[model samples]
Target: MTTVAARKALWKIPEAMELLSISRTVIYEQIRAGRLRTVKCGRTRLVPDGAIAEYVALLEREAGR
Candidate 1:
């Protein structure tokens, strides 16, 4: 049987930055501005895949306006 690669449900801050092609400061700024959503697990922050998608959609909507 062939197997497909599994997608990540959660991403770390650095990973999200890389995925979004943004800098660390910008990522944190987005989170602080409520443009991006993140969850705190212990001392680590995690971004859900859905949040990233939502952020992109938000940008697209803004661009379309």
Candidate 2:
């Protein structure tokens, strides 16, 4: 997928995992621990584009931003 589209889509959990190369367990753990923000619809969890960016920024900040 193009960066433009990737920048636009609100990723479902599997898609987010594919892009981040993170496992489902880690993702769920992050969501539950509030390190990442997520929205749930029934049994499906969706992660926001902004949340992913913010989360990455948080990691960078924690590393000494």
Candidate 3:
């Protein structure tokens, strides 16, 4: 099994999109809605590993309700 350590702590927008199987619009929407957190460095936006996991967990919790 792959470990978390094997993954990057920070992911680019396209990488996040691919990993989440989501579109750029949806990502931006989520960010706008304060569902997902991100970091900005220069001209790049980065998603932290913890934020992705938190978003997924939030989805799961919402689905259970």
Candidate 4:
């Protein structure tokens, strides 16, 4: 049995892009830059919810600085 939060913890690339209103290119760029973290499951790349939140927090901190 999978809890809702457990299922939501991992997001596909397209899902993450949709959630963040960003393009595929932007997502890849973030991943490449190490600002966003991802994991590989078979051939699929998955982004964690925590990574997304951390990225947002980093941006917010940068904006504040």
Candidate 5:
């Protein structure tokens, strides 16, 4: 059976830009630099659902204890 849910999901560049509150250029730069990972479906690209959480962990590590 199918179900309905209000789940969050991987966003396209524009939605991601809104979530992260950054510019399109900056987001594109990160994707180009491989700092952020993405998935491709046909001609569309998307960041994974876990990407932001992983990125935050990396940031924490970089900060050092």
Candidate 6:
């Protein structure tokens, strides 16, 4: 049997933007506002997959309230 590659644990800014369908400016805004969690790998910033899911859940919670 063939094995499938594992998904990425970290995503770049552009990838996160595309996944969230957000603009570069908006993504930066979220990061600045502490709404979107990200980690720094040297000079590069990366978003954890869990962070994206949490962000979505936050939005859902807000909408439910």
lDDT of each: 0.97, 0.85, 0.94, 0.92, 0.80, 0.96
Candidate 2: residue pairs that collide = none
Q: Which structure is stronger by lDDT: 2 or 5?
A: 2
* TM-score of every candidate: 0.91, 0.77, 0.89, 0.85, 0.73, 0.87
Regions of candidate 1 where Cα sits further than 4 Å from its true position? 1-3
Off by over 4 Å in 6: 1-5
Q: Is candidate 1 or candidate 4 better by TM-score?
A: 1
lDDT of 2 by residue, 1-64 (tens): 6565337547898888887779999988989899999887789779988888888888889999
Which is the winner by lDDT between candidate 3 and candidate 4? 3
Q: Which stretches of candidate 3 lie over 4 Å from their true place?
A: 1-5
After superposition, the stretches of candidate 5 with alpha carbons farther than 4 Å from their true spots are 1-5, 63-65
Per-residue CA lDDT of candidate 3, range 7-52, in tens? 8999998999998989999999999999999999999999999999
Tell me, by lDDT, which candidate is best.
1
- Which number leads on TM-score? 1
Measured by TM-score, how close is model 4 to the native structure?
0.85
List the pairs of residues colliding in candidate 1: none
Better of 5 and 6 by TM-score: 6
Candidate structures ordered by TM-score, highest first: 1, 3, 6, 4, 2, 5
Candidate 4 has which clashing residue pairs, if any? none
RMSD of each: 1.2, 3.3, 2.6, 3.7, 4.1, 1.7
